[model samples]
Target: MNQVEHVANLARLQLSREELERLSTQLSRILAYMEELNAVDTAGIPGTTSVVAGDANVLREDEVQPSLSQDQALRNAPDAVDGLFQVPQIISDR
Candidate 1:
């Protein structure tokens, strides 16, 4: 009956002696805010890319567009013949 009531009775949870005294003061203030984020310093930082690092290799211009004309691409076939497109009998002419 101690360590947060032995972790609220191995988590079958039924807290309320004021929610185990307010969850042990909110788990010691979330472990003192994770020990103040384990003290940061990030030295010699060179891990950056594109905070507007645009225009380093943008080249586009090989143009050749005009497609679709074989009778307006077989004019939406429901089963075309001489201009092709009639599929339905999937496998087994064995």
Candidate 2:
């Protein structure tokens, strides 16, 4: 408990004596549980990325379709110019 409080003081945490005592017991249990996990033998298991079986692809079909006109494309712009959508000016031409 005293060691936990001292370390907490060095870490700039304001921990009371009772809080430090409770946290010290809990931290010891946590470290013991982690040590138990370290004793497992995972020898010949295949390494996997995702827990779920996934089979996704991104190979799109090579096909072209008719597109909208220039007037239809610029219909949703806040501002536009001659047959083109226009964006705001970033910096002054100083």
Candidate 3:
């Protein structure tokens, strides 16, 4: 089993021979580009977390405000029981 086949199995994907070959070639090119980038020298340059330069907070401060009551919140709910929104059980015991 090749790297692409192993990766496809890990991701639970069922790929044909053609797809696996194409993906393998693409992955190889990407890895080659990464290797080329690794050869570049970045000695004095500081590592950047964000491209946008700003130390100040751009968002407004959070303020406590009055919210809807339980009844109001449940008013538009499709299903409600005992002051809680009722949703269909998604998982079942096999």
Candidate 4:
């Protein structure tokens, strides 16, 4: 009836006794590491928004590319009309 068990129940998980014990130990170690990191002195350091802070737009130039024709695209359609896909209407005209 620990925090791990409670969380497992909430997530609809059915962990075995051994798995629960192992996870509890692992979670404890992870929490301890976080606590150790929290004790570090970070007074004069500015918070970094991104890892690549120097480059604002790190992307390639947008180029117009040739694509498949209408016939090629609609070739796999089960039902097509006027070069477009035809599907069953969900809403009725009231």
Among the numbered candidates, top lDDT falls to 4
Evaluation by lDDT, superior candidate among 2 and 4: 4
Off by over 4 Å in 2: 40-94
Please give the TM-score that candidate 3 achieves against the real structure.
0.44
lDDT of 1 at 33: 88
What would the per-residue lDDT of candidate 3 be over residues 1-94, giving only the tens digit for each residue? 3989999999999999999999999989898888987777998988887778774658766988799999999999999999999999989978
Misplaced by over 4 Å in model 1 are: 1-10, 24-26, 40-94
User: lDDT of candidate 2?
Assistant: 0.84
For model 2, name the residue pairs that clash: none
Which residue runs of candidate 3 sit more than 4 Å off their true CA positions? 5-17, 55-57, 63-90
Q: Name the Cα RMSD for model 4.
A: 8.5
Model 3: residue 63 alpha-carbon error in angstroms: 5.1
Please report the candidate that would top TM-score against the real structure: 3
Stretches of candidate 4 above 4 Å error?
40-94
- The whole-model lDDT of each prediction reads 0.81, 0.84, 0.89, 0.91
After superposition on all CA atoms, what RMSD does each candidate show versus the true structure?
19.6, 13.0, 6.5, 8.5
Cα shift from native, residue 30, model 2 (Å): 0.6
1-33: candidate 2 lDDT, tens digit per residue? 777888898999998778888999998899888
The full ranking of all candidates by TM-score, starting with the best, is 3, 4, 2, 1
lDDT at 87, model 1? 88
